[model samples]
Target: MAATARDIAAELRERIKSGALAPGKRLPGEPALVQEYGVAKETARRALTMLVTEGLAVRRKGSGTYVREFQPIKRVANRRLAPEGWGSGQSIWSADLNTRPMEVTKLRVDVESAPDNIALALNLTDGARTLVRDRVYVVEGEPVQSATSYLPADLVRGSAIEQEDTGPGGVYARLEELGAKPVRFVEEVRARMPAPDEVERLHIAEGTPVVEIFRTAFTDEGTPVEVNRMLLDASAYVMEYHVTS
Candidate 1:
């Protein structure tokens, strides 16, 4: 019997898993695969496509298919949301990332009506506009996540939260100063295929999915202070939550 494309793909998958095919190393081009595997062009193409769909390889336009360089960042729920992490003076990101670099590639502040879901979470009445803070987070020069925060327009009208930097500890710190500090948080996470815009913004490879996180911040009095929606590249993060009894 002839060696099927599945056989070729299985062999290549093992090579990638065993580190024989290092990240960034180009894979065999279609012609090369056909010649080496003695398979038809269609079979060779299917083999390569299989690898890509499995996230083991990435296809680049004008370049070629190569092993993926996936450096997954950990998103630790407890540590990142602790008061000491962002309420004091440290950035929440400091709780999870090591010495690797992370930056905000884009920042946009505006006043807009909250989306239906966001409005419900923030307890905003109909037609009420909120102050929106949107930012794109990059790690190691690669786009990883984008977050948009919604705060009551009246509550943060003149505060530094309206500014680009949001000061040392960010919005959480400002909320503290306003006597509406975030005392509790609820977060929900969901995953699905990336949207067209999300793929372009994050520069994600084809067949990669995205994780969506919705978080609501509340004051001790049970008043919701902020609602945040975050979209993350699934290939670049490990989401973890610690529960205490």
Candidate 2:
């Protein structure tokens, strides 16, 4: 009896999960698999494609497919926004993956007109400008999440929040110093297939879904000070929220 595509995929899947094929390690190419397994080209290709669609591996153009190295980052809702979290110059992310090194791989801050949806959320007039701080968060060298934070232009106009680095604490801390501390937050989450741009940016596998987190930060007086929209690779994160009665 010959090994079918399913059988090949099963063996490869086991290798991947068992760490025999380490993350970032390239897998046997189609030609090699076809020759080694005595299978047709299509059968070998189908087996590899199965792993790609399973989110266990990704095929880089011109390069061979490799196991995905992404580790799901836990985003804990409660502690991440607490004043004591980022306020002490410690990254709120430190709470999520304490020892893993994370990076802000991309940062772009500029003023832009508020889109209608953002306008409504921030109580801004249509076309009102805002200081948008865009960032891409990478864990262990793989991009996991991208975020765009919109702050009233006038509020952070000349503040450190407008700079590339928001100092030691980040935006929330800077907001507090500017007299517009974020005392309360509202967030809405949705999941769907990644958009073309998101797929490109996050390097997600085809058919992989993304988690969108739209968050609003308000001052103690109920004024909306910031609206941050975050896009996360669904397979790369686990959203955590605490509940209390």
Candidate 3:
């Protein structure tokens, strides 16, 4: 009996876990796998494809498959959202990156009609105007996340939130100045396959999924101030939440 493609892939996966195949090290090519496993070329190819889809390996154009060099960003949900994190003139995102540099690119600020769902989240009338902030977050020159925020136009019309740079503490701090500080937040998270546009924007590979987060920021009085929708590369992030009893 011949070993299946999955059997070969399982062996490779174990090697990777054991550091026998270190990050960036090339995996055996299809020809090599075929000769070693007595398997067909397609079986060898499928074996490699499995690793690629699982994010355990990467395929470079014109080169063989290699173990993925993974240093995933740890996203600390609770700490990052805490008032003390961004309230004292710091970026909320700083909690996640630590010393690692995270760049914001493709920033676009505009006043647009809020989608029905967003409007509802922000407690606005249908088609109400919103100040929309859209941007992509990159680390090591790789796009890792895209975030779009919606706030009532009337709340942020003349504020620095409309600017390309929101100054020291980003939007939440600015919102505080306007008397709508976000003292509480609620986030809903889900994972799914990326859409075509998302695939292009985030440079996501086929079969890679994305994490979608809808975070609503609320004032002390429970008035929702902003609704932010974020799409993160699943392979590039390790979601961390510190729960308290």
Candidate 4:
């Protein structure tokens, strides 16, 4: 009896999870898989494609397919903001704050027609072409957060700060560098099951959840400079907020 493509793909996925096939390791060619699995070329190809679609592996245009490294996902609990200077005074997670480099791994400034929700958030005319920035925040060589920010293009197109990479200092810091200090930020957070892609990118295990954080930053004049939606691996971070009566 011949094994099905699903059977082969499932076995390969388990091998990846078990570390038998290490991350960044190149997979054998189709011929090799066909020979080993006793499957036809088409069946082997289908199995490999399944792995790629599932994010367990990637196939580069000129390069062979390689396994992707597994990342540790974290669960974050919302906590009261550290009293003035608390974060600077205390050792929280032993994370190398000084060594962690902030980089803008992605930036897109295209004029995107605003969605209903986004238009309302940015106070834009319906169907207006807004400036949308898709950015990934990496710390210590790992992606810690992914965000998509929306702004009115006319408000920021002339600023170099919008186009340049702001290292170690996220958008907030960058805004300050441009002399538009972010005086306050409002955040709304919620948790949900990880999407298939999010699970793979965040390396979340089965049944683990993800955190969705929506933030709006405003200047002293109460002008909304940015509206950002961040997807965080819930298991990876703790949200801290400050409150006073």
- Superposed model 1: Cα runs more than 4 Å off: 1-10, 53-55
lDDT of 3 by residue, 178-228 (tens): 999998899999999999999999988678899999999999999999999
TM-score (C-alpha) between model 3 and the true structure:
0.95
lDDT of 4 by residue, 72-165 (tens): 4332222221112223332212232433455556656566888888778767787776677886666556566677888777666666436644
For every model shown, what is its TM-score relative to the native structure?
A: 0.89, 0.83, 0.95, 0.54
Per-model clash counts, in order, read: 0, 0, 0, 10
What CA root-mean-square deviation does each model show from the true structure? 2.2, 2.9, 1.4, 8.2
Roughly what TM-score does model 2 have, to 2 decimal places? 0.83
Q: Which ten residues in a row have the lowest lDDT in candidate 4?
A: 77-86
lDDT score for candidate 4 against the true structure: 0.66
lDDT tens digits by residue: candidate 1, 1-245: 66688888898899998999999899998899889888899998888888876667878888888997866688899989899878678888988786778899788999998888878888989988999999899988789899999999989989999999888898999999999999899988999998898899888777778999889999999999999999988877888888889
Candidate 4 wrongly placed segments (more than 4 Å): 1-96, 101-107, 166-181
Model 2 deviation from the true structure expressed as Cα RMSD, one decimal place: 2.9
Runs of candidate 3 with Cα error greater than 4 angstroms are: none
Against the reference, the lDDT scores of all candidates come to 0.88, 0.89, 0.92, 0.66
Q: How would you encode candidate 2's per-residue C-alpha lDDT over 1-245 as one tens digit per residue?
A: 88888899999999998999999899999999999999999999989988886778889899999997776688898988888878888777888889998889778999999989998999998789999989899888888889999999988878999899888878888998999989999999999888798999888877778999999999999999999999988878878999999
- The full ranking of all candidates by TM-score, starting with the best, is 3, 1, 2, 4
